[model samples]
Target: MITRIFPSVRRLHRRWFYGLMAMVMAVGIGLATPKPSQAGLLDLIFNGIQYIQLSNLSTQDEVRLGRRIDAQLKRQGVRIYNRDPQIVAYVDQIGQRLAAASARPDLPYTFQVVQDDSINAFATMGGFVYIHTGLMEEAANEAELAGVLAHEIGHIGGRHAVNQMRQIALAQGVAGALGVDQSALVNIGVQLALSLPNSRADEYDADQRGFRTMGQARYAQSGLVSFMRKLDERSGARPEFLSTHPDPGNRVENLEAMLESEGNPNATDGLNNSAYQSKISSL
Candidate 1:
């Protein structure tokens, strides 16, 4: 064993020791090398990728979006206002009543009844709402009109339209989206700033809010039920509004059930029916 332990053995041991040292250095270098982190990595792939600007839109932006769309819609075509001054007054009267009870009554809300025989109605952004003459004719009375108007009021007061703008701006980004030119992005924003397309959750919320307003203003909730029933019964000549706001099947049912618990209270009408008839007749 002593003879075997030669200087050559020492040389081999030194070589093996150096090999082990080299292996340790390799492992240390591999451990120290940095790997990619999980955060702020998306920016590398998407150029300035942005998201919904719900909280980003200013009040001015909201109002501007509303006004822009209002103009575009008017340019597309101004709806025929019933010729009868009384009809205009009647709609304004009920609208004011409902607006006063709305969450954002300070907004300059205007309600107009268009001389069209379609069971339809819609609320534009920026506190403008339109009701079809057909819808008014279909309504049993002023309370029903008020109920319908109240629902629209709920939509506006909920800021659903402005919220829509935020959604579009977010999805579209502060830059551009949906193949729209940068110049037309604002236009698309305005057009998309609708009230109803605001999610089923928003619709349900608006429905409840409007119902409460109807109750508070002493408008007959059964008017809402009757109106919904009419909408549900509608078979022919559906309006564009119908295309957007599908019949909330259980909406009226739920409203009736709610009223049942609240004892079906009395309603005081602020409508000028005689004037409405005269105005509509002229149109």
Candidate 2:
């Protein structure tokens, strides 16, 4: 009877040991697992659901988003081209003309050139459009520069950034963006400016909008096509503009389509002036 009892007691001990080890391993996995912030899974799920229900942003929200991006730009030490008021004014004048012809003509557009030599340009929320000095130098004439500006203005007019921001908020689970949390705007600004580019669809929409604006503003529709051709020729080793804008060939094709639909208007509607060349050369 003693031996039989001893066997039973050993079996019980072995069972208990195995159970304890299993429990320890479960707890170890729980400790090692990476969690999403302090918000936990439930909060992230709720935030994502709430964001999905949101439709349109208010005008005030758009302004706040722009201000946050402007702040970030300043903090990043991006140099604004201001050495020559004449050159600056010239670029702004061209931008203003395009904006006047854009769908959202009432928006207060602000066009600025950066001192960087890289051939790139971008537009953010609100009416802010930035042109790099290198892009200005690369453009063959005033019309070519206008083509670039109109494309950027098209992005602003179409609220493409707003669409991009909505996507970012959903992916990252910005708890405050769906509510009154203003800090979320700051995060959105940084991500939009530094990381994300507009989707291919968005790029195509901007291309169409710009073509219309150029035609309405009498900027010579060929300006866009010509500029794209030149851009394609020089696009080597991953251009900065290519990161944001589509491939130059695709853009050129789109612009040509617009021209074809419009009965093929003269490509030289806008021409370069001596004053325009002088201003560019001085830089």
Candidate 3:
């Protein structure tokens, strides 16, 4: 054994060891101070995914996204022609009326019609509810359109997108939390939302809102169900709209249940096959 190692020299190693410990403690304290990040790396990633998927967005941002989509339709030469401003006004009137009674009235609800023949109606961010000429043509009457718009409004008023976005943000990474760009999120979120089945929770909420709006506004709640019922029989027989807003064959049943639950006729919709077709034809 090398007793040649003196005790004094050996004690010297202790000083170095103590210094190293102090440095590590300083690093730990610096980390604990929490300057900006409240989440760990994993937390940040999870948040991003949670939010961008369908959850956390402000009303202002939502309206902005809707505006962007409206602009895009214009740039793409999409037809948004409304031959009769009254018809357009009628649609907005219905939308506004129901929106006033929705769960999230703070949303900026706006309704528009696109003169497209795709048999499609979709809801965009903010509160943009779009009914395509094709959708109007297919609907038996205004109540049908009201039902459709009400459902879209439900999507906005329920804050479905906002809640979905929060989940996505949680799943996203640190970079996502460090000021994630919303433009990219909407572009990405739409894709995700399109693929993923709208949660039963959302479907249920929209169902409630749609039926209530129709009933309260004196529109035909049954028309909402009727439109969905015939999707299996229509020429398109289930448009891309289904992918965005899926209903597993219980649409009428759901509406009926809602009506039974509500105990009244909210809206009066008698299907006018010829009238609907004529109005849409002008588009």
Candidate 4:
């Protein structure tokens, strides 16, 4: 009898809840339509739906969303390097180490190398991180490469991509009463990962988080600091990294200060430049 009732309840719950939510969303949109500010109405509706869908998004849901965006990105011509499995595995090993020490360790992190040589790395929600071959070549040591991976993981832990999606949803307005369409959200995410710059606040927050994560993972914090300095020197060329992550004023100085405040403990794990180059020599 219990088994019989459980299946019935499960079926009813899905149908009933989704129908009720859809109806409520529709009514809310209709009532919001006449508000003096169309933009304001849209904002209200989006916020309401976003709160229901994204603010409390389950880990499973977020991961599913990430998979869709990642698939779409591959379809749209993002070349992932498969020429060397060793290089790919090396990155994943470092990324896994950082993710384990990160604030959000439960997430299943994936690290992939892109074939591009433009010196950039990016992460979307659900612990997906990508590093460019160029960025790997630019790093002088293992710690520097680890530093970049930690920073990308930091963005995932902070759910900055979700926040960015919220802003995009607000700006574009919802496409339907149900909310920003899932397919649309995937497209927006691809754009965000590929081209859009994170807010200054997001950049600073990721920096702080990444700095902390690096320390926890026992990588030399100076690696992150030095990498930032390298990017700053290239301010004229404006590397894809700096283009995607707007520099908060005094960023390197701030990181240096953080290192100082922590007493700049001597960490010896990833500072071996020769070892790092040998690991990625195939690239």
Candidate 5:
């Protein structure tokens, strides 16, 4: 009677263990590469958790993350320029054109001006992109302004922020991520918005994407190349642009190569300085 009862207990334990593993797999957590020592069900549940792949994150999750980051940026004193309807409308128009030409044309892209005088622009997750007033003031023409917007949009299209956050979460040891950590998400967003620069590869990829978008949108393909050359010429002690983007020299080189591949076409068919200037004069 004792032996028969022991066999029944062992069978119960086996069934319960397999059921737990099946549940873990169903939840998409057990797909991770298991550790050699983590053969047992309990160890699999508790040990050596790995990073969640970016593919696991949905587009809605990305938009939510962007909204959180955008909120944090607003709270951190990042001013939004809304006083000039003309400026806002014009920027939005150009941004829409670029987005239409982008790979992810259906994304709800938003382009806004920041009141800062720094020559920098950044894109968080989703389709949010910001350009500083100083960068606008320095742009030679409408094409140049559109070029910057296209570049920022490229960052969004590439989902750079989401990729960055995945790495950030992994580094922070937050395993089994399902995108519900509000505090950690906010902190990561702040870091991305205020301090972290995208990798050089990311910067180059964005540049290429922007270049293609500008070409397809009938804007001057060389506009970004010219902008990078100007930045390289006048790069003094760390400028805001350099702080968040790749070096001007490398960017210029890459853009020049791209331009060479696609020979010069007619320049941008967009607004002239007078049109853009009159609109921005309100600032």
Candidate 6:
């Protein structure tokens, strides 16, 4: 009986191995040969594995993935502030203004307020931006808050998160093979959005892009620079913004130069500090 059981087990293992090899070969061939529909053989395998490169993710794919990541973030205990509808609406209003003036305005943008008190803001792919309640309170005026939101939108416009995902996949030796599984990619995205510091080049690009967006939206250009200056002057531990977004050595100076180059360094659109504070008094 024992001998018979051992032979059957060996046969079962052999069958499983051959089956896996066949599936892998089929995936390779399907990838090599283009299909008419974007969703083809690749979509059928492994519960809908996306075979495309991360950098080339379509707008729909990016948005879908972002939704998944956002859901997971909520599940992981990142609370969304919903106690006050007005606060969320106000933030969304400012974010929408900046996003409309952004380079990629066609993407559906969703701005959420995080309940946390940390002075940090971040953007994931597919036009999802989150601003902390603390960050809102920290801002002296509406433009300062808008500056942070615009910076986050700039990240989405630049597709910095997608680029970072591709680089991480390559470094992990999975990109060259079957590409990352969708679930794994989503996990990676969550980690990147939460803890990773963006590359120095990406930070500078975001700042420049955000500056332009802010100006285009007619928000006072000084808001961004002033906010950064205020953060830079803070003592004690670095703020989450400074920690997550590495200071590009001279971020404040560069932003000031951009304002100077625009030849209107004194634009005062969103600089009413008293009104701004009154609006956010509930928080």
Clashes of each: 2, 0, 43, 0, 0, 0
TM-score of model 6 (CA atoms): 0.82
Task: Look at candidate 6 and give me any clashing residue pairs.
Answer: none
Query: Which regions of candidate 1 deviate over 4 angstroms?
Result: 1-61, 174-186, 193-198, 236-239, 263-283
Q: Residue 275: error of model 4 in Å?
A: 0.8
lDDT comparison, 1 vs 2, better candidate: 2
Q: Write the per-residue lDDT of candidate 2 for residues 113-198, one digit (tens) a residue.
A: 89998888988877888899988887877888888898888888888887777667667766453452445656676667655777
lDDT tens per residue, model 3, 82-131: 78886787678778887887776777787887777766676656787778
**Local distance difference test, per candidate?**
0.67, 0.77, 0.68, 0.86, 0.79, 0.87
Sequence-dependent TM-score of model 4: 0.80
Which portions of model 4 miss their true places by more than 4 Å?
1-52, 175-177, 263-266
* lDDT value, candidate 6, whole model: 0.87
In candidate 1 the C-alpha lDDT for residue 195 amounts to 31
Q: Residues 5-113, candidate 1: write the lDDT tens digits.
A: 7898999999999999999999888656634542333443355432324455555544555566666766666575756777788788888888887887777776777
After superposition on all C-alphas, the RMSD of every candidate to the true structure, in Å, is 12.7, 13.6, 10.0, 11.0, 8.6, 12.8
lDDT of 3: 0.68
* Candidate 4 C-alpha error for residue 216, in Å: 0.7
What TM-score does structure 1 among the candidates reach?
A: 0.68
Off by over 4 Å in 3: 1-57, 72-78, 82-84, 168-175, 189-197, 235-237, 269-281
Instruction: Say which candidate scores most in lDDT.
Output: 6
Q: Candidate 4's residue-wise lDDT over 165-240, tens digit each?
A: 9778878885444456677789889999999998887887888888888888889999998998898887467788
Comparison by lDDT, 1 against 6, better one = 6
Worst 10 residues of 1 by lDDT: 175-184
TM per candidate comes to 0.68, 0.76, 0.68, 0.80, 0.78, 0.82
For model 5, give the 10-residue run with minimal summed lDDT: 44-53
